[model samples]
Target: MRRGMLSIVLGLALAATACGGSGGAQQGGALQGQRITVAAVWTGAEQDNFKKVLQAFEEKTGAKAEFLATGDNVSTFIGTKIQGGQAPDVVMVPQVGVLQQFARNGWLVPLSADVAKEVDANYAKVWKDLGTVDGKFYGLYFKVANKSTIWYNTQAFQNAGVQPPKTWDEFVKVSQQLADAGTAPMSIGAADGWVLTDWFENVYLSQAGPQKYDQLAKHEIKWTDPSVTKALQTLAELWSKPNFMPGGPQTALQVEFPDSVSQVFSDEPKAAMVYEGDFVAGNIATTGKKVGQDANFFPFPAAPGGSQAPLVSAGDAAVVLKAGKNQQAAQEFVKFLATPDAAKVWATAGGFLSPNKKLDASAYPDDVTRQIAKQLIDAGDAVRFDMSDQAPAAFGGTKGAGEWKILQDFLGNLSDVQGAVQTTAQRLEQEATKAYGS
Candidate 1:
């Protein structure tokens, strides 16, 4: 087994280097000495893993690649750069809506024919559709997040005599069991509305299915739809349980995402589990807990009456900006990133998952990550992009005014589910009218 694993690893490394070498040979002297800037909303370890990918690109193509960490406000920063005529050659946009907006405004360069062909061959149809806008390809989805995971402390579950739940009923029973043992069953970072949005997406996707999820995201269905109510009521089952959440819903609304992870894995754990993306594994490690041993995750179970288990997923797409200084080099770098070989670099680095269908599951460093990659692949068409991220920024992405604030309110007051859903419907209608003048 060890020999076979080593052979697979070596094969991937050779393939990556060969892909990079061929890319350099094709670009030849045109991109050899050019400098290109790439901007992304990554810092710390995430940025570190990305830099390794960039370094490989530079080494292979002989082009200097500069990474600009855009922090959390990439849209603002990218807009400022574009206005100043200094947009990065490649900008990694986290939201498809924003990428489409930029493409529609003519700020993005359509992918070269070669790059488009590579994307078509390497990515799934959904990913291809996401990168293409107005019938033209503009972005390459490189990294993906599996949001249908619930990270848990293994010891905590063992101590509570509860196994990981496989269905929503089981999930509830497990939560109550954990709570009865004097431990908080879950930790929620409702303070970050995005986290709340994720919670709702998983429930909505699983309960209402993808067709309605698509409608809700595109505003074809009102937020007050019966499906919305049903999802919320399902979520409220756990939320309403006494002592099920750490410090209850009010305290959850004050806990940030990192703190929520800490609460689950800390030396004195306040909670047993946290529902979040695969990235939470890294956060668990940071708290001095070993991910596969001390902390691990199970797939979020199917809600009762739901069609199938749903996987709410999100990814960053690399789009070339028309205003960039080195278009040729930028295009080459994006093409490099689209390859399975380039994806393996960061996939093996941990805390990273690629949407490239061609990437090998064996490329991931551990069984936990491998499971995540397999879950994402197995989800296939069942996976839906985070609905809030796909919605208009005014309604879904705004910090304190729209979906975020309203959902935070609901978290603090579970008894007002109908009121909250109705208000969300009205807000979406108003925001959609303003955005589309409809």
Candidate 2:
């Protein structure tokens, strides 16, 4: 979604002319002793790749950058930090709703004009729009994902004699075939509510079409709309059958997101498929299966009204906090993120996609990730951001509440509950109305 930047060698050259002190000679006077702590939901390999960016930053600016793993509930964790006057100097926010909410609350500082200029040069207008609140820039996208994908096990597909399907009916038929052949058809990580939201979004976008999808995302149309009803019914067709999931719905509810991905590629796995963003590749890497041969992905199938699903995408954005003592260093750090060099660090490491138009396609380590990035960039005006991410935190970002909880409830009790689809849609609308005040 954005720009490329200067080499670290340039920073070292420029530092000598800007400062007189021996220590400040190698480090610019402005950022000599600053330490910026960044908070995000990334951990393990995700955090490791990010640390590479931090390593590059320290080499350039002489400021120490440390990462704080805020776990899966980043919005709530950061909110609590801001409330206590202990906010991280920078944050890699995953939700647009959370970014806009923080901006509106005046918790984030406006990025400098230089950062905006870089954004204008490298990113698409849609990316700038997502990071901007009320025409002011408070954040910029760093990494992006194409969420419209379903990864499967090649061995399982071969055993079940099923190819990737193109439509909802065909997908269901394939699922049944896989089940009948004694292959676990799907591995859902319903324990994490966000995964369920991705499922709903892919189906709703494909079936309802873009116009209605946009209306519902902004709450201009209620969740109880006919489009929403149809999407829920479509999802119900799969959720109603316990046989479709590994160890049935109850066991599926206990599995976390990473385990769900690993299972798809595991030897004698509990299940053979997982759905989410392209980031699933990161988890797949640890499972010892090569992508494209042992594990592969296909675009989410088209629903009834659409020939194909539009690309539903999401990205994490970097922002500076006004409350941090190292806010100036934090701004410079965000500025570095705009550069191609920073993106290249993660791109070559796999499981990373940058929105920067200038980032070379050759930077990616593998063809699968490169092609995924190409799909995202080429989607152009056809891209729609995650719908739940566009809604308010109370309605979309909260755990055990809001759309996340409502959808998870619907999935868990699909068959036993009467009128569950309608009930779930009405509940979603109730939360949206309360959160959006519409």
Candidate 3:
């Protein structure tokens, strides 16, 4: 989270000359190009793929695009840079929390009206609308990775004589059956804290529909709602089941959830199922398992006889800065991003789901990916952005990690579920007040 001196220098230089007017100059000196520096939170292979796409952009536009790609503590670093006035022309934050902060602070500007129209015309309006604050669109949502999914081992389910659970009772029955057969039923870890947040979100989806989740995001619904409390209590009950989660509370207190997910992918008497986002595809591939064939998914089911709901999902967005030196150039860059070509580039990258409706899923590398992509697009308006991300900054706050820890503690203890929900809800409300004038 510490600010680097290099960032400080860049911040000073940009502020000195560019603050008074749009700093839209083509690259100075030998750079001799429309130089735009973009920041993203992607790293390693994901980072490499981004570079390739930016290179494609550079080649097509004859503009010089540079990337400030980092993997560690991106939110803090981006916050520091914005505060220091050294913000990039465009920043691709992984979380909506950071984007909302930038919008609130006036660091980001609404997408050009023309850009907004194009986005709405070409894709769903909600994607563009979700990034907005105070009636201005601050970001262009390029891709989304939906998280509310249940991953299962195909062969193990067959061996256990089970079908993908179609209801909540069925889900629990399948898990207990796996446990009775001497196989670890579910792969879960909460050592890093945020892993527990997944359970909160999933149960929240089950108890309260997507619209309620959106209300929770807006702080319109009180945190002490009975539904919210029930969601937390239900997760505690599941976590308390015998041999339910691998290594139980002890291992969860020590391991990251992704590692736990890898266990389900390869380790045997194999784990039967895991609930996670699309990111688990990579972790599974890293374990030498293919997703569609070796592993597959089903949506978390509705309450018995309750209305079926769209899967809970989340996405990342790219945005131009209102205070940036190069507004028009950045706007054009965003246009390029929304095009079919760029959508193809991102789909091929393996970690993203492009929002462009025109990009054919058949073009994806495998059937599993194609099926999932089709499902996401066909999900229509049912897809809700991540609640934590959509929430007012004060409630959603940095406490997501801490809240996850609190959830784990509440689950392990079992007796304190109601108290834990009440306390966390109060704290979140207080933080929201701090973020926005109540």
Candidate 4:
């Protein structure tokens, strides 16, 4: 199907139901008067938006859902729940690798037949494949983040007379121009290691393409591969510039992700741009700056000697755990979430992007968000999942994992590119051996 046509069809569907679409209305008969529990890592505003969706489900079907915010370490918390002989009916697994682990451990149950059909019809093959484990469907992808975005302070860009660059060389030149205008060009946020990993992944994917990205994620290629080193060198082009990064690498090592976004939008802004996912929009909103006006974003530019710009993304998948008490009600909720109307609910609430192709782009609350949703759909087969999130937790997801600390150290000293690559390769081998017994 043509990409533009697909987008139009989705937009029409969302527009038609913009006023009175209740996601659970279709399944109210089967789910009435039942209650189920849901567990996920979302909290604060994100949790609130999800709760709105659950409320609609409850209102339509007469079913009740209790939400549990598992914070950042959802796997650890879920494991503890399982060990205690009490688990939530549905869990929002944040990583495909972790979901696969749970499925392999026989802790997850297959989706109900109707929910499976809804997934088959609404999602692209790549999304469905991510939720599948060993030929069985066990999860539903509900929310997505496009990490290949470079958010900028609109006023800063206008004041500096610089436009968003389309290529890496242009990006560096613009950064220099912005610096000359007395604005630090970027916020690094190296304190949180995942942000650093995201930096490396985008450079790698843009430079090495999706095939290499997949191989690296699966550990078929060592971190010391020539492609890996090349990508690191490319990152250093910006990282090594003293005036480009606010407070240099050391300050970045102390800043968390939210603070990083704030740095770009502060009254006296610390930087002109922040490289992160769409979630930054929510953080920007909290600063009382309107998105697309005070702040807006452009796609991360194509790297030198690379393919077209790639979209690096990650999502939360809804999985049914075998230990849950309300299995039937849980299945009903999962099916409801799979519908385009359910996706539209959260999409309209903001700070969410659904992988469900049936959802219309018009359902998004604003142009900035709609643009992001369109970019995700336009990406099609080129969308690559976040590399670190798809790797073993001990190697990538953990706080002090080799991928995190090694990259953090590299950000601290851009001159040690070779040493960083070698150390990362060594640690990855060790961790893979330990985790997989290979």
Roughly what TM-score does model 3 have, to 2 decimal places?
0.84
| Poorest 10 consecutive residues by lDDT, candidate 2 | 1-10
TM-score of candidate 1 on Cα atoms, chains taken together: 0.90
Off by over 4 Å in 3: 1-32, 79-86, 304-306, 391-402, 415-438
| TM-score of every prediction relative to native | 0.90, 0.83, 0.84, 0.89
Predicted candidate 2 versus true structure: per-residue lDDT over 38-79, tens digit per residue: 887887777899999888777766778998888777767888
Off by over 4 Å in 1: 1-30, 416-438
Better by TM-score, candidate 4 or 1: 1
Question: Per-residue alpha-carbon lDDT of model 4 for 1-438, expressed as tens digits?
Answer: 000001112234333432232344333444556778899988877899999888878876667899998877777888889889778989999888879988998889999777877877887777877788899999898998889999999999999999988888889999999999999999977889999889989988999998999888888876667888788778876687868788788888999888999999989898999999988898898899999899999998888888799789899999998988777667778888988977888888888999888898999999999888888888887888898888877777778666788778777876665665566556656766665445
lDDT of 2 at 68: 89
Clash list (residue pairs), candidate 3: 23-325, 394-432
Q: Model 3, 141: alpha-carbon shift in Å?
A: 0.9
Error of 2 at 283 (Å): 2.7
Instruction: Please estimate how well model 3 matches the true structure, expressed as its whole-model Cα lDDT.
Output: 0.67
Residues 354-405 of candidate 1: C-alpha lDDT, one tens digit per residue: 8877889899999999998889988876788988888777777888867787
Query: lDDT by residue for model 3 over 1-438, one digit each (tens)?
Result: 000111212344333333111112122312225667788877788778778777766665556788886455666777777678776777786666667777787677777765676577667666776777778887787767767677888878887888988888998999988888777888776665555666677678657876787777676776667777677667767777778877776666665777777778875534778777777788788878878888888776765333664466666678887655666667656766766666787677677777677777765777777767776777666677777665543344344433454555665565565566677666555655555555
